[model samples]
Target: MADVRLFPRLAAVHARRLLANPGISTGVDPDALRSAAEPFVTWAPSGGRRSTNAELDRLRDNIRAVAAACGWPGPAGQVSRASFDAGMGAFLLESGYLPVAEALRDDVWSWIAIALVPDVCLWRFEGAAPERFLGGRRNTLQRLWSRARVFDRGPGEEDRWELLDRLTEDAMVQITERPSIGADPKLAAAIGEAWVRTAAEVGASAMEALTREAVRNLRITNEVLCFGALGDADLAAAVGEHFQRAAAATASQTGQASG
Candidate 1:
């Protein structure tokens, strides 16, 4: 892991008003900074300024369109990327946008992130062993290692694909709870209930425990980045366990207070 720690002090959001126009940088809310830095990251291939705050509604519409095209249910709330891999693969096969290998690679990472943040049950590959399944559910978190293709790489080509899968449901809750991202409030409430129940099962608190868990996970992520062990595929998984624990704890506290 890298020596970088994920603490509020270490992660400061720095706004830049110097460029003919103002911008942000790699401090304080680094993700926000990264959002601003996207231009610099892709400066060479770009010819125009990026669009402003894209907003949640647009993202929602896009998701809905994609979902509908794939025969997914209307009004996407929290669909499993892994479970729908077969449909996606079939869709890709029909579309033929890129090479088969590249398409597969992209699909694997995309689904992994979906699995990490939201609960997912990966579909099985054809002709695989039967025992490697959870009631017909294959390529699950427990059986992630069984699917080596997701992480395999040639020399000099880093294998960060494995980072997409997290072992908790916090990521899913986080997405569902986001107020700006077209989240369903009703689903959020249900998620809160589930979170509280899970937290109570482990006896957790909302204050120090939940926040501290976030802090620790960020630190661990910083360590991973610093050591050059970080890969895009695995970037979000570091906070998986911490997010689940914290969300559960907070949900539990909120539930008790409301009750």
Candidate 2:
């Protein structure tokens, strides 16, 4: 993934744009955006990851420190559904438009993926994965379990998450739409329900399942002009065929270029 300090760049550009066009609302609460960006610039952990008997354990401790400061429970064994949902809501409400804004700033899809994970984990783990580190079972923790598989091998910061790589130009534009401000809340809820049901059955974390489902649903809905018809089996097949064809063409182009 590209090194994208999305908030910094957006701050400068948006600030200038606001000055010149005061009437144009960013659709982002300005103060919330600033607060979200603060961690990116100022929250570097000192003495970074160190060589210890259990590397994952150390990482978990680091995360717990962060979660504790954010008023989350300190142990995975202590997590409950209600606590998890509350933290998730708080993070989501506080998140404002930083995720979209950052994605726009980076001009890369990865920023959105990076931004979403921590917030998603707020709900997915309810603040417990950190404690899993102590058990040497960090691989079973929701965020880590899902994310670790994304990196088969890596150059540290290189993102191996192909799903994120597939978020096309148009998808990002549509996703970054001011959903919080004007999108039908029912649609979002339905999407979330569809995601949780489908994902959990497949042993996917909510974030992983939702991200994939959201992208797939968005592409199909946009192409068919009918999110309303996602349940229509015939229309879904047609939209799926469209996705397959596009994927094939992209693969062919890449092969030809490489050849």
In order of appearance, the predictions have TM-scores of 0.22, 0.25
Off by over 4 Å in 2: 1-88, 91-184, 205-214, 228-259
Q: Against the true structure, whose TM-score is highest?
A: 2
lDDT of 2 by residue, 1-259 (tens): 5232222222333333322332212222333433453354321233232223243234334444445654544334333333333332233223332243332223111212122223323333433233221212121122222222221223344433322233322332233233431143333333333333343443343234334444554555554465544554554454444434444454576579899
Native RMSD of candidate 2 (Å): 18.8
Reference-based lDDT, residue 11, model 2:
30
Top lDDT prediction, candidate number:
2
List RMSD in Å for every model shown.
Answer: 19.1, 18.8
